[model samples]
Each structure stands twice: as structure tokens, then as C-alpha cells.
Target: MESKELINKSAKKIWQKWSIAIRITPLIILLALLKILTHYLGWEVLELNALFTSLVAGTIFLIGFLISGVLSDYKESEKLPSEISASMKSLVDDTYTIYKTKNTLTALEFIEFQKMFCNSLINWFYKKEKTKVILKKISEMNHFFIELDKEGVQAGYIIKMKNEQNNLRKMILRIDTIRDTNFVDSAYTILEAMGFLIGCCLLIIKIEPFYASLFFTLVVTFLIAYMFLLIKDLDNPFDYSSNGESGTEVSLKPIHDLRKLLIDFI
Candidate 1:
């Protein structure tokens, strides 16, 4: 197996087990501790200190929230297919036409085209097992198709391709599975959004005595805590991605290499 395949597989497995609270909670706790320290150190008690305190704390929380958002996006990117892009789809469609058509080719040219397509897919998939599995089925179909295209066309090859197509279709369906949110993620996101909104409201209103404002500010902090956990939960695409099938690692390297092997025959 290629190194890229191993990396993707490992990433998928690790992503599957990711716990948002475990990864994100500590940071929230640390921020809370910093706030407490400021209060004890008279940092929040100095002249006109309430305004300064809010600004500093708000800045910290905002940065942490942004980081969480970035991580969420990262996980999503891992789950999606590069082929989902329009340009790549066009490229694949172009090559697929070659296979769809009946044409005369020197054995070497067929093998060359096959190898190139395989290589392109390999780069596209970044060497994941799900892609590997897809390639294997495609190879089986291609081989049978070649046999049928040889000296005589056979009816059985159609049956074989159809069977292979079914198998491939199942694999494609698996890629569509998206996991549901466990309580932690759902609750956390809800809490964080509430906190952000409440905190903004309190700040804008300038609630006096500082204590009342502080209490509301704490609400915002709590929301950050929840968001931290939610981000952790949503960061892995395999289990947490849009589909259950999204998180699996897939690679097209084997198909590319297999196509290269055909060139040896020429």
C-alpha cells in the first residue's frame, strides 16, 4: 500500500473516534481561568476597568471561536471528494467517453491511456482505501470489458459488468452516509450560539454595576464552552461528516499502478 493511503486511513480512523469535548473543552476552561485571574488581580477593578475587561475577554473568546470554526471546515474538507469539483468532473467525463466508445487502438496506447487515468485518480484521491476498493471493482469491469472487446463479444461479459456495477454502486452509496449529531455536539452548538448572542447584547447595552454585566458575560463564556465541544464533535468527517460514507479513506493508486502493469505486456 502507498503512504498516502495509510495516512488517509489513519486520518479516517482517528476522525471516527474524535470527541469534541476532549479536544476543545480544555481551551475553554483555560479562558475561564484567565478571566478569574483578571478579577483576582484587580485587572478588572482598575479605573474604567469594566470596559477594558470586556474588550480583552471578548477578543480572547472571539479568537477561540474562530479557531473552532476553522477546524470544523477542515474536517469537512477531508470528507468531500476532489472529484466533486466541476473541472475535475469535466475531465473524468472526457476520459470516460474513450471507454464508452468502440475504437481501434494499439495495445500500448490503450495501456497508456489507462495508466494516465489511473494516475490522475490516484492524485485525486490522495491514496485512500475506499478509492482503492472502487478501483479494484473498476479493474474487474475493465478486464472483462477488454475480453468482450477482443476477438468476439460475449453476452456473459455484460452480466459480469452489470454485477460489478452493482457492487460499485453499493460502494458509492456507502460514501453518502452521514452521521447524526450525538447530544454533545447538538447541545454544545446551541449553547455557544446563545452565549455569543447574549454576550453581544449585554455588551451593547452597557448594563451597569459591572456585576450584572459580569453575570451576563459569564453566560457568553458558557456558550464558548459549548461551542468548543461542538467544534470537536464536528471536526471529523468520517463519523461526523454529512454522510456515514464520507469519512472512509479511499485511494486510486492501485488502479493507476495496475494500468501501468498492462504497459509491460506491450
Candidate 2:
């Protein structure tokens, strides 16, 4: 089978990812131009060196903190799909064992359950289905494991199967939590507020020549606004539909491979 390309985020595609952030460019430029105009009109520009410096310093630190926090979760999310695939593989092996142990019909029924469970995951990861929808399916898979108990399968195999089932449920819910939540809601609020203030500062502060002010204002504002959008895009690794930077998302190939493996069983 052909490999799916993800890491080859060409410069053009990378620029496209900036599209969301670029929407604010016109406004940032307007602010810079507006600042330049104030100089031409001979209006007094506020030159608070310490205040401007402190604000930029504080905001930069805050952005750094947010990036560090969000990255940990994003890294964790990347591993979950592969781990989940492994758990399902183990679970399928247990179910197959039951089939050979003379509970053939019942075991095959459970195999059907496995297929549905895996398919639902692909949909859920795509955001086509909500958390509760997937939770209900997971609950059903759990109960199916219980049915195997009466088949007189060895206690050890049953326990192992149940454990694998638990692992699957745990990882899916983990992904759901990451998808539905933010790294820190209040932190994001603060970042946006600070971003607005910095934009205002860039427009109102006194800098050197008109050209210098224009250069600093445009460059600084663009970096701040771009990172704000990029951080938000990174915070939700499962947001596959976003136009944000490519390859930021956790790859789904493991899940797809698991789906293919399940289909082979059916």
C-alpha cells in the first residue's frame, strides 16, 4: 500500500496554514500605518520604554508557557492511536481464542462488535461523531466481554481480555478529553487580552523614524498574531479540518491499520 504523506509540508502549504492568521494582517498593517500617520500629524507619541519593554517581555513569557503546556498534551495524543491499536489487536486475539474454544458462534458475534467499534473510532476522530456516541459503543464492547465468561473460557484468558478492553476504553476516552478540552481556558483568555494590548502598544508607542516604526510594528504584530492562532491549532490535535500548520495533527494511520486488521477478521 502507498504511504500517506504528512511530513512533506511544502513551503506553499505551510504558507496556506498561515491563512487563518493572515486574515488579521490587514488590521495589523492598518495599525502600523495608523501609527505612521500619527507621526506625520505631529501628535505626541507615548514613549514609555520600561512599560513597552515589560509588556513585550511578559507577553513573550506567557506565550512560551502556553506552548510548553500544550505541546505535552499534543505529544501524548500522538501516541494514543498506536497504543489503542495494540490494545484492540490483543482484544481480537482473545476473542479468536474463544472461537477456537468451541464458542464459535458467540465469538463471531463479538467479532462483529469489534468491527463496528473500530469503524466508529474513525468517525469519532474525524469529529463526525461526539464523545457520548463513542462512549456508548465502548460500553457495549465491555458488556460483550462479559458474555464470554459463561463460555467456560479459562479465567486467565477472560481476565486478560477484560483488561485489554479496559485499556481500549481508557485510551479512547483520553483522546476524547483532549479533543473536547483546552490546555488552559483561562490562559487562552489572558493570551488574547495581552495580544490586543500589544497590538495597541505597537500602534501608539513612539519609535524612531517612520520606516523603523513601520518595520517593528508590522513584524512584531504578525509574529504575535500568527503564534496565537498556531497555538490554538496545536491545542487540539484531532482537529483535522483546520487550515493550520500541517503535520501538527496526530497521524491516523495506526487507527486505519487497525480498522483494516479488524475487517480481515470479519
Candidate 3:
């Protein structure tokens, strides 16, 4: 009973880890069952042969396309967070320079903006509810900048500050959009269904040896499951926690370092 409990616990952990791809499991099971049925029945027909062959080819192509799409999305997810952190650092540095060189009072006002911006980013890392609040504060920061302009801040410096603010806003919006976007599209799901159906058809019509068909079916099913899990893991690079030895999980070190920089500068 203890062993069974342990197994169940382990399985639950795995299920939670791969839950993003849970929708595909039923289709995979259906395909496996169909493959097994085809072997058991030993159906041989010319029309079925042509249909199965075509389907097998299409399934392979679809899988390839889906893999490429998933990989591209994974790379983008991994890249965007670092890009945001870098942009934030640049904005902070620019604010510090303005504080030191031009106007101490304006710089002091900008410190409030800096704190709000950093708080927004930290909130984004922890709680999504703070996003709206942070965005509102960012709008208020813009008005503060307008006030600085009215106070006869140099035109060139104001332009630079405005450009930095705009860049930060764009980067934050991109991060928000990417976080909310689904990595796996509807077309990928549809293609996966078609692939499974086709795999079953191919197993039934083409493979003559029952043992060979069974072996291939098991291999194919395992490969398909592994592929789905791989895609799921890569889909959200920020959330992936399964790196084995090399510790390849996406790092928030940039944010931490920036926090330190802010403390020192402020």
C-alpha cells in the first residue's frame, strides 16, 4: 500500500508537471488502441492501404511543423525576459544620470517613478493582479515628466527621457502579451488529432506481422508522448523546473542584480 501510494504521488507530480499537454493524452490513447485493434483484426484492403500511406505522410509533416513552431516560441519566451531586464536597467541608469547632473529636484521626483517601475516588475514576477495598478502608476509618471518639461528641463534631456519611458512601456507590454499568449495553437491540436488517427490507420493497413505492429505501436506511442511533454516543457521557459544537472532553468538573476543596483543608486 505504501508503494502504491508512492507511485500515485509520483504520477500526480508528473501529471501536474505536464498538465499543459493533458488534452492530447486522450487522443494518444485512442491512437494506441486503434493500432492494437488493427493488429488484432489483420485487415487487408487496397483502398485502406492508399489512405493509410497518405495519412502517415501527412502526420509526419504536421509533427515536423508543430515541433518547429514550439521551438520558435520557446526561444522567444526565453529571450524576452532578459530583454525586459536589460531595458529596465538602462532606464534606471538613465534616471540616475539625470539625477546627478541636471536637476536634483527633478531627479528626486524621478526616484518615485523608478520605485514604482521596479515595484511593477517585482509584482509582475509574483502577483499578476498588480499589473493594472502598476500601469496606472506608470501613466502618472508620464504626467510627472510633463511637469519636469514645464519646469524648463532641457529639451534634449526631456526627449531622451521620453524615449526611454516609451521603450520601457513597449517592453513591458510585449512581456505581458507573451505571458498571456498560448504557445500551442488550435491548429497544432487539430493536426495532432489527425496524426494520431493516421498513425492508427497506417498500423492496421501496412504492417503485416502482428508482433512487429505491436512493437512499433508501443514505440510510436512512447515517442509521441515524449514529444508532447518536450513541447509542454519548452512552451513556458519561465515556468520550467525540470532541468536535471546543468541547471538550465531560466534565471531571474538579472532582476535580482538590478534590485541591488537600485538599492545602491537610490
What tens digits encode model 2's per-residue C-alpha lDDT throughout 1-266? 12335444455467655665667778776876787787788653678588778888888899999999999998898899899888888888888877877766778898888888888888777777787888778778756666666666677987887788788778888887887899899998998998888877777777777688778878888888877877887799888655322446778888788788777775
Tens digits of per-residue lDDT for model 3 on 1-266? 99999998788667656664565568567766776666567563323456665765676676677778767766665666577667766666666776777666766777766765775676565544455775666566677567767776677766776676676677666656655565658856876687567455545554546566656666666566556556655554554224321122345667667677777566
lDDT of each: 0.47, 0.78, 0.63
Candidate 1 lDDT, 12-62, residue by residue in tens? 667645543345556555655655555556555334346656764664566
What's the candidate order when arranged by decreasing TM-score? 2, 3, 1
Sum up the clashes in candidate 2.
0
> Model 1, which residues run further than 4 Å from truth?
1-33, 41-118, 126-150, 173-188, 194-266
Q: In model 2, how large is the Cα lDDT of residue 165? A: 75
- Model 3 residue runs over 4 Å out of place are 1-50, 70-77, 102-106, 125-127, 150-152, 182-184, 198-211, 229-252
- What is the Cα-based lDDT of residue 246 in candidate 3? 16
lDDT of 2: 0.78
TM-score against native, each model? 0.34, 0.82, 0.64
Model 1: what TM-score?
Answer: 0.34
C-alpha displacement of 74 in model 2, angstroms? 1.9
- Count backbone clashes in candidate 1: 13
Error of 3 at 258 (Å): 1.7
